[model samples]
Target: MSGSSRVLIAEDDVRLAGMLEGLLRSEGFDVEVARDGQRALHLGLTAGFDAIVLDRGLPAVEGLDVLRRLRDSGITTPILVLSALGTAPDRVDGLNAGAEDYVAKPFDIDELVARVRALTRRASAVVPTVRFPGGRLDPESRTVTLDDDTTTALSERESALLELLARRPGQVFSRALLLEEVFAAADDPGVVDTYVHHLRRKFGRSLIETVRGVGYRMGSLS
Candidate 1:
């Protein structure tokens, strides 16, 4: 779930855009490049990017304008704005316009990667109040509380998958469905299996019953 997902980068600077794309790819991210704000808005609206690396100064439409439009359209993908206009007002403006974070130009690649990672951690996350027979899964904080008041913390992906299963305690969910709803990695269905394995290890195998030829579900603990 970390660094193995898609990211869209919107930068008008050809060299900077290429650099950002290459950097993200080197870190194992699926990269999409948009050279201007209009294209950025189009891609941001239609495509499902885990996170966006946006530049404040873009052709056609400014990055902040794109963010405003996306927000208006109810697109909540985390945006990290990268710009050369490094000023208190500029950073404030970018953040105020709906960017989750701002990075001034000529920034350290590692720092940029760190910011991107943090933003993705939040975007791909699910926070739902999901209930099963004897337990409740809280996605916001990634915690599972049992009927006995015992609580166990889960990772982001684990919590998301658990929340999906908890929604229908006895109903089975196939790997494909889980991939679509929980894993957020539609390219690989096998990722669901890994998270399911993690869930089994965390909450005990009996809690999640896997149908031999089918899929898995949250079973009654009572």
Candidate 2:
């Protein structure tokens, strides 16, 4: 990684965790260790990281549960699962639970680090900084910066909604479309309106324009 990429290590094995942390740190990654699944889940939800190394047999909360919850909350951080369960079904279970990659326990440290580096590179390349009328949004950091240079952090859903509209400025998107794209399919379309209201309140009323009897589009921001 060219820049310092933050990584979270969620492994309960003391010796193994120490080794991973030491190696990752030596490789220039800023690493944080979480000894239990609860701590891992909390950090994953609240903090920002380029990638995460998660252990499936975590204590307090299983690693798979943590992964699912992170995805449910709209966290797009790349995750790699480390598990002793090396069966085909086990790998599928990890991937299905939202892990980007699965590594069987007793893995090669060099290979694991390489996989993490690849994940961070892929993530950085896919999400670029989005500039709109009055501000620019950094999707990677989930923050928006106004022309005045004031920056505000956004929740995962808020950032996703804003980025979607900002990317296709002035393109009308209906509530149903926004709901399906930004939220759970089971979520009511009204949730779109709710989030739009949130964006306007945080930014300004002119941040988004509502189309009468239709939907919403990017506003002039003036």
Candidate 3:
């Protein structure tokens, strides 16, 4: 809380990861993302994050296994599990694996941000910066300044979406996947298109490309 808190996101779903990364960046938290649990685990050990947003279902290594391994190694960094599994049993599984918190899929961005802040605030040190293409975002400030010095205040949703895209530039994402990451479980699937429209209007049509029958892609030109 005193400085920028770093958050590592471990999720396989491309669109969902982008959404979360974008939202958290706007909240002033430094964020790093991994496409699967194996890469996530490797970073979890080698990368110094204030906390982590881990997905229970992951590729390469199961999220639970990654958490368990981290705990076994005595890494006490707080972990918040983000999963589509909403049942009590599933939540319990994540918690038992040493996660600091469990967030069900179809989560509210505000709620997710609150949890990340709470967890990171407990850390005594600031999370380090992880840079990528597009621009460097200060996770602690929640402000984004483009390469050309253009800047904007991202709504929680916009930030999350952008973060995910920044994680892997030029990757296409589907509307349904975006919906799952940014909106709460109660949001209707149709709302994803609306959000995308808003994002295109703000970020420019060229920044995020429509994939026709599939979904959307960022950094289409680069």
lDDT of 1 by residue, 1-222 (tens): 454877999998899889989998988888999998898888877566789999988999988999998775546678998999989999999989988899998899999998898888886674435666677777678898988999999988888777666644445778877787876756888888887788888777777888888888776666
Local error of candidate 2 at residue 221 (angstroms)? 21
Give a tens-digit lDDT track for model 3, residues 1-222.
446788999999999999989998888888889998889887876556788999988989999999998876445678999999989999998999999899998999888899898988876554323233344445456556666766666676766666555444435667767777667663687777776677668656665667789887554322
Q: Which clashing pairs does model 2 show? A: none
On lDDT, the stronger of 1 and 3 is 1
Which predicted model would earn the best lDDT?
2
TM-score of each: 0.58, 0.61, 0.55
Task: Give the local distance difference test score of model 2.
Answer: 0.86
Taking every candidate in turn, the Cα RMSD to the unseen true structure, in Å, is 10.5, 13.9, 15.0
Query: Where in model 1 is the C-alpha error above 4 Å?
Result: 1-3, 127-222
Query: What would the TM-score be for candidate 1 when compared with the true structure?
Result: 0.58
Model 3 ranges off by over 4 Å: 125-222
lDDT of 2 by residue, 132-170 (tens): 777788988999998899999999999999977775563
What lDDT does each candidate get? Answer: 0.81, 0.86, 0.75
Query: Which window of 10 residues has the lowest lDDT sum in candidate 1?
Result: 163-172
Q: TM-score: which is higher, 1 or 3?
A: 1
